[model samples]
Target chain A: MGNENRIVNGLLKLHIALCLLFIFAPIAGSFVFSLNSDRFPSLPLGEFSTEWYRLIWEDPLVWQGFANTVVVGLTVAVIATLLGFGGAYTDFRYNFTGKSFYLALAMLPPTIPVVIMGLAMLAFLSRVNLSGTTISVIIAHGVMCSPFAMAIIRLRLSQMDPDLEAASWNMGGNQWQTLRYVIIPFAKPAIFAALFITMAVSFDEFAVAWFVSGLNETLPVKILGFLQGQVSPRINAIGSLAFLSSMTLIILAQLLLRSPEDKKS
Target chain B: MKVNAEMEQQSEAIVKFDNVVKRFGNFTAVEKADFEIGRGEFLAIMGSSGCGKTTTLRMLAGLEDPTEGAIYLDGEKVNGKATWDRDTPMVWQSLALFPFLTVQENVEFALKMRGVGKEERRQRAEKWLEKMQITEFANRNINQLSGGQKQRVALARALVTEPKILLLDEPLSALDAHLKVRMQAVLSNLQKDLGITFVYVTHSMSEAFSMADRVVIMSRGQIEQIGTPEEIYREPYNRFVAEFLGSANIFDSVITGPSGSDGWKVDFEGGETSLSKDELPNAVQGQAVTFIVSAENMQLSAPDSGQPGILASVAGEEFIGGTAMVFLETETGHELKVQKSHDELSLLNLHAGSKVIVHWAPESCHILPGENL
Candidate 1:
């Protein structure tokens, strides 16, 4: 029995190590490759240089892509968080007819293929003369990211004691007040989580933005364009920089949203 | 006497229910609940689960509106009023203290929603926190508090609003037995000091008996009886109330003779017993009836000890420190529970298969209308 237990533990540790290597090796490689002075990004004895970083920093196209990414990411984050919080709160607190169907509809976009969802939104938006615009790209990204926000928000809402909302109402808090005070306060961590995931997803969103944005190219689309047109060390520099910023944002988001109870520990 | 006094106080009731029938879909949660809660009345709605005691409290709190009839508060028709507009607050069974908010913030929430100035709200919250004896913990988040402290925070939150009526739904049910007793004292004292009406809903007779000024006993969503705790214990209206209250031994009985100047003899399960005219004022010969004998009132004598009593064998015994519950099976196959002090049971030397005699005074047993179990 002891031998079997040891073997099982050993295998589990090996599996974990392999998974970590699979995820981080490429990111680490890209970081190292971006620094290698060789134009072809090759082997051992190469002088580390900041040429690619400085090149991308001086490139106007790269700067435009970065600016577009921030704009689209921020817009998608705010809109998706609001939509997701409202959807989750209503689902948790109400008992009206057809509620199940509405929630299922809210979850439909994420469950279906993103390519199909993107194409469908493009077609529908075009019928309304809304396709191929910056706002359309923003809306499409919000749609792509909201399921994640809603899922986390729902998990948090379900963990909440429903009696608190009832207590609020019983204490002379109107519906809006209860939502503003009790429900929103309880949902703060989840809302921040929504923002973090939505922002990340929107920044990285490619298929939907590529299909929907006719003129306004998002950062990922513009990068894809650059890569398709010509491969450069500048791409690696941009990728590494984006990875650093995303990780920083994720960590900062987590610290800001940490529960008071968790902070005690 | 209590009923008359309550009747006089009804005209000035702070809250009144008029033929209220609340239903959820096809199920009726509260059936024709008609009662008046006087100013500063500590009323308790009590029953087992799904008996609609909590549903009644919810309706009064305006969380659940009555599907039929109207509810009036302070003589204003409030049937369509939202929960917040009613100025009624509730302490939930789970406490439901805002886990993220600090203790003072949770208490100050109602004041904040009411647009009270920040300084005033803080001062009021601090005053309540101090009165609840949780002042030191006011700055701490809710999850950091103990169960007793959480209960106090819930109380402070509900009371800080200073509403005319405060509703509580089994507030002490989650506490440990010892803590429940102590919180009961704290809540009762708080209600008295505040002079605010508290409609407490609980399933525990001890809680209602110890804290409530009057209790409404319910069964299957209908009011069984409403009276003082002493009145309820001494005069339960039906078999349900008697059994639900606790430790009652009941038997089927039939009137055996016409009324005389003294009393009437009735054929009980195994033996004949006489009930006073006062005990069964409307009973006639051969009419089936039901009667209740409390566990404590059941006197056990030895077989052929020269006292007239029903013969039964001791089936089991449970020793609960100060008192012991002696289980017996009568000749007619009826179960009788007799509770006596340990000393008394020891004197009788009660053991399984020991034959014993059970008897009670005519007036000690309350006669109720017969119903099939």
Candidate 2:
């Protein structure tokens, strides 16, 4: 039995190693490829060069795409976080008719196909004369990102004790004051997490942005257009850079919103 | 009982509940609760779970508003006033400290909300934390503190506001027994030192009896009785209050004879006794009543004593904490619990299945007028 247990432990260690390689191999490979002088994918490392990154940066179209991504990402992050927080607070604190229905509606956007949601929004916006505009793309991205924020914020709110809010009210804090001092501070971490995810989703969005972005070009759309015409070391460099930036933001967001429970020890 | 002019002129009770009714659909949480909390008085509302005691505290805290009637704070009608405007602070059961903030920050938030300057808030927070004996933890996160330490921080946080009244909802229920006793003393002294009116809610009889000047016993959304601890324990108004307070040997009785000046001669199946003054005072002749006698007041004797009172046979005996619980079965097959002090145990020397007589003085029998025997 002891020998069998040792064999199981050995297999478990091997399995973990394989899993780590499977996860990190692609990211490491991309980082290495972005520096390779060759434009084609190859295993042998070539002379490291930033020429690809420099070329991508100097491209006017690429810069325009980057600017579009920033605007769309920020707008979606702010709008989605606000909507998500409001939905979570309402679901947690009060009981009303059709509350479950409202919660399901809040979750519907992220669960449905992005193409379908984009098409529905495109149809609605066309009727309202809002199609083919930057505002339309921002709103569409916000819609797609909101459900993610709402789910995260709701989980955080549910874990918190309801009595905390009541305690604030009893301590002579009005409704707004309790929300400001108690609920907001306790939810800051989840709020930051929601913002990070929302920004990432809007920045990397393709399916929905391709439909409604008439004159506007988000980086993902612009990148797809460039890929259709050619493949290069520059594309790989931009992909590597985008992947790193998203990872850094997510890590920083999680740190900023660290749970006090984790630090008690 | 002496009333000073200033106190009398401060006719405004710190907290008052006047015919307030709160209902969650068909179930009534608090049914027309009429209560008044005096300034500087420590009052406890106690009951079993689902008895609406916590609901009553919530209504007073303005966390939950009553469906009917009004609440007043310091003579002003505050039924519609926000909790912050009422100036009543609550110490929550879970402590509910802001886990992300330092202990000092949690305590100072109230003062900051009231627009106190940062420097003054810091000084006040430190002083309160010192009084709570948790000054060392002022810079530590609340999650880092022990249960008792967190409790003290919660108290400091609530008290720093220095409101006219404070509401505590089972503040010490989560502490270990030793810590509970220690914090009870601290809280009792704190209330006395600060002169703040305390409206506490708890289910522990010892917690209520040890700290409260007055207690309101609730059952099923209605106030069963409200009195001092001694009065509620010794002279409970009904069988519920009597049994809720402590152990009692209730005898099924009836007023078979004529009424006396104080009460009447209540006759049980295997006993006859005169009722005390507080119970069944208006009992008419031949009126049915149930007499309740405390276990400590009962005397167990050998059957041959011929005391011309209740007679029973010893059912069993068990040595409980600091007391001998003698169980006796009366002639009608009713069991009675008699508590004998350790000093008195040597005199009785009780044994199970032995014949004995269970008797009490006429004054010890409280005859309650009720249908359920």
Candidate 3:
């Protein structure tokens, strides 16, 4: 029995160590690279300093790109959530014609090649003379993020009891009233979850933004631009900061929207 | 209480279903059901599952629309109106309270939507919480309460709106047996004191019979019978109604002999019974028929002067609460149940395999012709 327990404990500790390494390896490597004075990322030894972090902050083009990314992420989150919510509500509540076809169409974004969607949008937008601006980038990001939002929110909506809405209606609530009072409140957690995930997707998206963004330079594209040179440690600083921002935002959103029982004591 | 009682009495019929028929694509749920509930009447729709009893209640509550009929509340046709417009509230089987909301907020939600003052809503909510014996749970989240406490909170929420009608869809079916009995009494007394129109749906006959002013029994999307509980139990219209309510002994027979102006002699299973034509209207000579007799009305041993009756052998004996059931197998291999008081059990001393003479008067048997039987 002692031998068995030792083996079991060893396996559990090994699994936890592997999990932590898998999560933090990339982050720690990027941080180390950002501080290394050696311009080449492959170099083993160099004088450590905060000069790269200062350079990242001083770059006006990087700040512009960061601002553009934030704006695009927020815009995409709102648009994708609205479209996904409409589609989910239609599929769940009503028996409209072509419901299955619409649902299938809604699922195309996550499965299709991002480059292909980006190329298709580019061709479509160029013909309409709307390529490369904030509108085009916003539309492309919204389309790319909607399927993920729909998937998350639909999961939450499906778990809800339909009778609760019926009870609201029986209590003298109209369709709008029932939606506002019962359905929306029950779906708030799902909406927040979808929002955070969509923001992450839009903020980190590169391939599609590379094609659709003409004049608008999001942070990811700017980082890609920096990679054309001799491995700038300033780019490493930017990557580390972006990773930290995403982790904090996601954890905060999850904490805010957790079920009542999971809230703090 | 007196002022509220007078107001309820003066209120008109709260809900009326006029031949409502609800069908799903090819299947019918409620087939032309008709009923009216007066104000402040605690009516129960009772049947086994899939009997359209719940569908009927849903129609009245406006949770569902009838495919082939109209519903009226306060003399207004509300067939197309949404549930919220009907001014009726529902207590669900799952107690569909907002889990995130405090008990007070959940109960006051409808009032808030109606634009009632915040202070007034809280005050009225406190009143309903007290009435439902849940005042201490007023500020707690719904998930924090126990099952019975949650049920009371849900009831308080539904009643706090003071809607013209309150619909309950199997609200107590999920409770444990002990809690069910307790809540049943609580609901019964609460409805009486509040004097609000209650349209309750349930599959349990005991639950329906205990509190309903009138019970509607449904079977296969049709109303089987509608009457007071006593009338329904005492005089069931057909075999389905009789069997669904509880127990009844059904016997197949064919009329044989007849009397001049008095009664006829019916032969059944090697025994002839002298039953008046008035007692057996469809008992034509040489015609098939069935007779129904309640178990409690059956006598174990006949008096020496009574008519000759069928002999039944005790197949099984069971002692119930304050009564005993003697399962009797007739000579023709049919089972007939006879219920007797505990004191009467000592006289009969019934056991399995015991031969007992089962007897009943002509008036006790409800005779049905073969076709209707």
Arranged by TM-score, best first: 1, 3, 2
lDDT of 3 by residue, B224-323 (tens): 8888999888778777887786577766667777866777766677465665687566557887666678899887773343545677788987888999
Angstrom error at residue A70, model 2: 2.3
Taking all chains together, each candidate's TM-score versus the true structure is 0.94, 0.91, 0.91
> Cα deviation of B297 in candidate 2 (Å)?
1.2
DockQ values, each candidate: 0.73, 0.66, 0.62
User: In lDDT terms, which candidate is top?
Assistant: 1
Which of candidates 1 and 2 reaches a greater DockQ? 1
Compose the digit string of candidate 2's lDDT tens values, residues B221-312: 99988889998887677878877876887677777765466656767777788775454545577767776889999886767877665677
**Candidate 1 lDDT, tens digit per residue, B23-119?**
9889999999999898998999999999999989888888888999988888778887888887888889998887778889899988998899999
Q: Among these predicted structures, which one has the highest DockQ?
A: 1
Model 3 chain B scores worst on lDDT over the 10 consecutive residues at B302-311
Candidate 1 vs candidate 3: the TM-score winner is 1
Off by over 4 Å in 2: A2-31, A42-50, A256-265, B1-12, B258-264, B276-282, B309-311, B318-321, B369-373
After superposing candidate 3 on the true structure, give the runs of residues whose Cα lies further than 4 Å from its correct spot: A1-24, A42-44, A256-265, B1-14, B259-261, B279-283, B302-307, B346-349, B368-373
Consecutive 10-residue window with the lowest summed lDDT within model 2 chain A: A256-265
Model 1, range A1-265, lDDT digits (tens) per residue?
9999999999999999999999999888889889988777667837889999999889887887788889989999999998898788888978888999999999877777878988999999999899988889888988877877888789889988888888788777888888888888778878887898789888877888889988788888887997998888777888898888788767766675565245344
